[model samples]
Target: MFSSKSERLFTGMIAAALAVSAVTPVVSVEAKQSEKVTYQAKKQETIEILAPTSPLVFKQGEKLKGKDRILNVKIDGKVKKQPVRWSNLTTSTIGEFTATATYSHKGQTVTLDVPYTVEGYELAIMHTNDTHASLDNAPKRATAVNQLREENANRLLIDAGDVFSGSLYFNKFKGQADLTLMNYMQYDLMVPGNHEFDLGTEAGHPEFAEFIQNAEFPFVSSNVDYSGDQYLNALYSEDLTHKPVDGKLYEGVIKTIDGKKVGFFGLTTEDTANIASPGPIQFQHYIDEAEKAVKSFKQRGVDQIVAVSHLGFDDNPAVDNDLELAKRVEGIDVIIGGHSHSRLNEPVVVADGAEPTVIVQAYQYGDFLGTLDVVFDQNGKIVSHQGKLIDVKTYAADPTAVSLLAPFAQEIESIRNAEIGAEATAAFDNPRDAGDVTKPSVRKNETALGNLITDGMLDRAKQMDGEVVAAIQNAGGIRAPINAGPITTGEVLTTLPFGNTLAVMTLDGSELLSALERSVSVYPIESGGFLHMSGMKVEFDSSKPANSRIVKAQVLKDGQYVDVVPTETYKIATNYFAAKGGDNYLEFKKAYEEGRVNDLGIIDWEIMRDYLVKLQTVTPSVEGRILDVK
Candidate 1:
């Protein structure tokens, strides 16, 4: 240094320089630490926890683990999946619960109070089939529905069709009376049965159209083509819709229940074209339409499918049926069926495939309400199910339904109580061989009621076409019985409620013989085609084969039983239903098509009522009209 002070100053300056260099290094280190801390805080703010698309719903008694409980973490606008650590999740109870889900990502942990549900996911379906306008017990049915709905919020009330005919309610009101209560009970969906088309030919289904238009719920019909019918086509939607409007008709519908999509389609028997007056309405092949419906539902991401089928349970192997549908279709989960009027006390499960299809049907009348509770797994597959028929009569009448039904019941009461000026000598029992197969039944054997009905039909047909020789009545056409008292107009209406007109057909003796063979084809099994004779008698051997069962055939010629000449042409009378191939009367259908048949345009119940008035004191008995020998 230059001097002692200067040297000290230079030394101090050098010391200060050294101090500044060391301090500068320390400040640079602290600034970098602050920046690192700020970056860590910003990164922690960008890391957000996102819940799953589907709600975290766990089954009862299921432990929360695996990928199902994983949470998605969003980091810097990118999603990152991470397993969530859930706080003490109690799934033993079935209800809503809140729990904390801890998600950790990139050394940052997030604890969220996520809401979840632990439930059995039991779907309750309340169904009915073939109620057939039996509204006498509708109030009780409403009560049953209300009680069941109260028990479970997840429930659907559906009808499998045939709510159009069979009782005084349909006779007078043309389904309006039933509709009032059905609306009150809130039916979710309904399918049209064959009988729904009964009035199609008369007025192009004016009453049916009105019934459907005024309905509170929608209709699903996949196989029936309403496009041909002017009245129905307007309301018909060929496209499957997720949100279907009430009172409209659809090929299929997607119903969202409990955050899950359930698909529904409907099918009526193709035999409806022959059995009922569908008029311009066309019926497609059921299997084909059902396949299309399932495909459509699946394309829309619906897994659970329900078919409301009017096909019989195990009716005709030649025709379509629910059993065949269940076996053939792959994705259908449940079938609520009608037409055969099967009383499924428990659900029938078809488990031949990977998944099972459950089938249930209530009996003919509003006698029972079918209930099915299906438990679905997390994958939307049916894990377990329980189904049963609840007797409508078991429940107390609902006050609201009773109030709704009062006016209808009052009007029906007046018509039902009016006497027809005829007294029955005995109770004309319309027996069925349901419990005891060996006993005589109206469907399998000639009963007094069948004889009376056929006699009335013959007498009425002779008035229209005097040449009409014999009258044949399908036993299935006879619905109810005439009590052993003063017969009322309601009794006759209930007995022959289908509103079938008289038809006279000209058939060769050979064709008549073929008809007789067809009638007795299913003889010990109680076929609906069983012929009840008024002017003919047939003896058949039950031990013989089906088509060759007839042993002898006779026709009443000039009030005498004579042998049927195969070469001779004869005139026969039957209901329009049978004349037009109903109950598989092919010969009658042939005659109808060949212009050899004449429809009298008279209602069958009116014909029976007039015949009863003519007979004054009605005492009819079975006179060995149909003989079956071993």
Candidate 2:
């Protein structure tokens, strides 16, 4: 009876299984009758649609069809192929295009809008450098910036800094005027030049710190170490950030432009340590810092890099410059440079690395606005570029900027128009030999202006220290020209805008000789360290080597020139910048460190103004004070 029951139960179970199998296929067919239902069932809450990476390039006259319209649709990490149709997909023109791609399966559809270029992605950059606080043309620069920004959607405006000293505006407003205009123009980024630190030693960079605090844009400083400075340390960040805050400083920043990532970092010249009063702030090796920046950006998946560099275009190779930085380091795409006041009308291409790097600079003052249009492929490599300098004078002043500058201008006008009870018979031109090498440059050769400046410094120093025998001024400290007319306080302040204090140093004849050697080290090539003398005569041979170039050094004692004795001590007057070892004056630095230097606590412009008043009518001339025998 148990065996019979088991056989019956097994037969019944087989019949039930066969009945279910027959209905299962029919039910499956019915469920898949609508393809939309099947797709929805496979669709996940999270879907990733992968398209070709941007900077997508298409050849001229190419059609957007076939495999180009395909996308990888990923659901739950499983990818499947899907065909897409594009709207407004025209490739006949060579420019950027925005288009939408639609994917449809049965009754289900999804869409995505993307931007691509026909040939390559075009990026427009507007840059300025070494503005030197010449805010008179700020309105015109604003006009140019506004027009350029309006012309292109992909654009950036940047500055390679020195917006501190040079004019009455900086003397009175202390960079606030420039900052106001820079804010109006909407600058993207900036790097500090040497002159930005001019007030560090005297005022501890109070105005500069305020300038940074009030700026509406961010500052990048990859090689400059602000940690040593109490004021700047609080505002500086060593990390690379994707989201940068205005009125702050960073080592590096990542910017997103049209779904592409671009990296920017700042590099101030290392010469700042010797040339400017950075106080306790320090500078690092540019190459090392630059390499680290590039690597950090690369690790963050940023390929396009720009360096807002205060290093000169082709300055002293022994120190640091943009050209050297580009060659020594890799992965730098563009360099917007300043310092040395290079006017690069066209972009300079350096192709020493795997990819080419482009360098550009606007000349000193607010005269020109540099513009560069660079094209990049999908790989973020610069393939083609065009660069040019737009004369800011050509553009009419922006009315908005003008209105913003009105109050500052009114105050500056009153101060600049005040007469100093002096007149010049001839225009005291401050010439530079950058374009014409044969011409005499105030930086490379002696000038009447230099003489007058040093004479004033000597007069002031002698009043304080009777034993002061001579005075000297660095060529870089001499800024603008004096017109042939009534001398105004503005002109004097503009010419000597650094606010340097008069200093007297007791140095032996040998030490003075060493300072002279350092001054003429780069003889014919204009050097900021070049010395302009008063109460002294120096004759050097240009053909001879730098250290031993001085043939004869004489000091005026009681209206007579006497040969300098190597062991004899002589009291010299010069600006505190020079006495403190500025412009690489190591011997003077040693004297200062040894307490042989006394700062007179008087402003340089004040000395010049007072001396001008002393001489009501002056006719200063270059009188063979400095001669090159070669």
Candidate 3:
């Protein structure tokens, strides 16, 4: 559920009108044949009122309210454009009266029989977020949404983004085939996620551009500045605007449904600066931008504002979360959120004033479709809402997406089933602990597994004509703790599933010291702290905070341990993800900017697996060589 300013005003006007309606009454007016007299009065006491030049001119089931007229009415069901003749007015004063009104559609008019019962309309909002291209139905999520569409004719299908750059299928297809899947499903509107920029920001693929060009929907983002990037600028520049991320430019979109105007907009988290290759992309404050967008929508007279945001939900009760945004921002009626992959099985209702705003999100990877059923009363204020995470697993797969994805299914299944090797015991239980990397077997400095992987990368890099002087791997990317028993290829793949390529760079001993200092000074608990190196020994103090943890950094030169001096550069090997500085290693991102990084053109997992296979029988042991922590 998302909201814009017009929605708030519409809800407010409805509430005001409903409040004023209680004092009004419906009264019938009688006119003589010779003179036409209009009875326009305060009529404060009248509860039901009907007035016309002739009794036969009135119609049944048509809502009419003058300065002071209220009538008890009910609609039996929907009717086409036609004149409904009423035989009774049912006013306290007038016993019975005859009335009729003409209804028409597409220039055709007719008369229809009137019913005694009343009927109302229902609004359904259907959305999906974080769909990272689970393109095939073998996973069963892609087919589930297609099946759910059967329930509502006036339905909206929206993706909150992150629809690119994941899985072997996407890596193989480069998003051309992924867009085809969304095209076939007919998504009405979409926003791009960080991964959408993966193709070096090129819109040169005419086929890909043609698909988005032919979309029956719009791709909206208020944050991205594309003036520098021609590829993306040509494809989606027009829809771009300055909006907010953490606190900056928030823009909302306007859409009309069933003759009632509805508005929606989206925001992505600012964390992309670290998570993806953002490259000159700028982000703004999300809440501030949202506030401005709402104010703009209010000026336009469009109501029923919905905010489709990718800011992610805040689960920690201790954090002053975005649920605060709903209460803090006055006009927004609902928030449809994603990122952080949360599951909202029911709507989180936060009271505003007379009406409360609803927040909802389904878990990620097409496991569910979030359905929010909102009913706004005659005054435009939401009376009730029901949120549901429609389980995709429950529905049988739709054959079309399944059939389209069948060919690639076997490869994925094979990868998932492949066996790697046997383990004697689990390597370590606390893989997430930053301190785990400082311990004997799991410590990046001494862990047999870490040494094994870095050695592999060095071997691969050496094959590329680059002698590996240094090698480093972030412990966080090591997924499963290597078990002591059988380790299958499936386990290895799961541990290093991200398909990151290895990169080799030339760095001075001084620069290497800087890199080590940055890595050791930061105790990243479960992330960004553990450093596995092949040619360097880094010592850090545990008593020190992460930013200043490094005690001593040194490198081996011709088998001699030399203290790192400030100006020396050394050639090093690492993964492209780290070379790009993914793990708060802004120093690496800076290094790339300074022209100090080079790609070795080898996949990280391939090297590690090869290194493990060299030994027919492998047993990992801890030798406290890397860390001399005291």
Candidate 4:
């Protein structure tokens, strides 16, 4: 009976102490950029801080007594100011005390009670990048996204950009259908990926704006300037919110759940400037924009920051990849990344200040959804993180989303099921097979389809500019080759799924030399230094140093060897993907940015299709165009 009475008294004291602490006055906070205050408590308790909301915590059975001394302020983890008010806190039960904050201004005070438990709030991030309009339910990815939403109602669905452009579905539906699908999936937000601007016509923007206005969630971006771009301006105007960090306007967003604040900013790779037709709009530096947005969010009392970036995961820190971004930017909590279409079987944790930021991505074609579950403490620090690539194949499709896509699926089925091409043998098998080009009929090093693509680009470039010299085709881009028989429109679409236009760039001999060097550097590395050429003979020694392995690179002009010098410039023909260096060719990106000019009127696939039908036969054979040997 005595022990029970003692327990009751102890519990009552704790309750009284907490009530008093909740009613205490909020400190007048004047925060600067990169600076944070510490409210040290005499006890230990877990608390959470959410966005657009204020919360508080305090030591149990303790009261503010005696004079208060200002504690120190931390800036970038170092002591900056030494003047935070400290009160003497004590617990009658002899346990450590915890502290929280209250917000009070002009005598209008509100109290927030902290959750005094060990577990923090779980933030589930469902991210997709480079969807490229793979919206059909039968294909797999569309079904996977919907399943995740049903399985995890608390899920935050985000797209890392490039949601449109690529598949025949985009061209047939003009993105309206894709937007509807994303709406059904209930995407929390999406950033502008490079390919979203596939159509060179400006009229597409206004329609896009209308789509956003009706979207279930917002589209977030920090660096893309839509001020003068009337089409983009119309679409994202209302959703635009300026942050406090910099006076610059941003298309980023902040969302809250359970008293916890989370901020999301979007960034598309600057390389988009050269690849896609951004017209008059300018893309800001990725690092600069990210830094400003993070600072602005922190100023708004939002410490959990994520960047839905379209930048690919680069192994090198110098290039634009998610891994490089994590290392370069310190405060980003997580990066839902895309554009490289990397299948990161696992997530990579990058250290950000006192915590680690998670970087993740799902491979393209709706095969997977990247999930990052993060838990944060009261002080806005991440306590624990769990991430994985959830394969879409494992989940049962939601009947609702499937029903929503029924009409679109029917339309696609009419085309896919209609036989366009017949193959003598399976033309292409996936990468899992040995010695297989992407298609079964074509070998990797050389293929009829690859030759046909290179020839088509060269044929079109000659008509556009008399100076056209050489063309190159990436092995990965050619999805499949003809099986020596009848061909149909559907077969062609499957082979060249993306609506990539022809782009001709003038490259100086020096730049072309560097490109050739890169093409041959890792010759022995599978899928490394292979090239399909139309106007050049490239020979390399595999045993040579990586950076200087190109033994010989010569361009033919008028059926004779041209006296090419490093200073001389020549016109080159290729698709936009290579110009932007989609496959880790930084030199190509650099060339497109500084030297290549876009002639948007040209279309490569159309030309290739026309050329193939005219020839009535395509027997591609490697004719020592690119020779590499140890």
Best by TM-score: 1
Candidate 3 Cα deviation (angstroms), residue 586: 29
The alpha-carbon lDDT assigned to residue 623 of candidate 1 equals: 87
Over 1-630, each residue of candidate 2 has an lDDT whose tens digit, in order, gives 345554321111111111112331211111233322223223213334566555567854566668777767654457787776778888866778888777654443455666787885556899998787788788998988888878885689999988887667888888999999999888989998887887896326777899999999999999988877878889999989989999999998898875578899999988777656889888899999999999999999988899999987765566688889999999999999987567799999999999999999998787899999987765678989999999999889999999999999999889888988999999988999876767899988989999999999999888877888899999999999999989999788789876676778899999999899888888788988899999999999988988989999999899899998889999999987788788999999888666676655456887898899999988859899999988
Candidate 2 vs candidate 3: the TM-score winner is 2
lDDT of 1 by residue, 1-630 (tens): 245564321111111111112241111111122312233212123455675577777777676568766777766668778777888567876678887777665545556667788876566799987776778799999999998889887799999998886667888999999999999999999999887888897336777889999999999999987766778889989878888998899998898877678899999988777656888888999999999999999999888889999987765545688888999988888998987667789999988777888899997678899999887654556778999999889788999899999998899899888998999998999999885769878888989999998898899788766788899999889999999989999899889877676777889999999999999897788888998989999999989998999999998889899988899999999987798678988988787655576555456887888889999898758788899878
- Evaluate residue 586 in candidate 1 and report its C-alpha lDDT on the 0 to 100 scale: 91
User: Roughly what TM-score does model 4 have, to 2 decimal places?
Assistant: 0.62
Q: Per-residue lDDT of 386-468 in model 4, one digit per residue for the tens? A: 88887777767667767777787678767654534333233433232354333332223555456667877787778766788
Pitting candidate 2 against candidate 4, the one with the higher TM-score is: 4
Candidate 2 residue 487 Cα shift, in angstroms, is 5.6
Question: How many clashes in each candidate?
Answer: 0, 0, 75, 20
Q: Which stretches of candidate 4 lie above 4 Å from their native place? A: 1-117, 137-151, 200-204, 238-250, 315-321, 352-355, 413-441, 444-448, 457-469, 474-487, 496-531, 538-553, 557-559, 562-630
Q: Per-prediction RMSD in angstroms?
A: 13.5, 14.8, 16.8, 15.4
Q: Between candidates 2 and 4, name the one with more favorable lDDT.
A: 2
Model 1: residue 421 alpha-carbon error in angstroms: 9.2
- Stretches > 4 Å off in candidate 2: 1-117, 202-204, 419-450, 454-487, 491-630
How do the candidates rank by lDDT, highest first? 2, 1, 4, 3
User: What is residue 528's positional error in candidate 4, in angstroms?
Assistant: 11
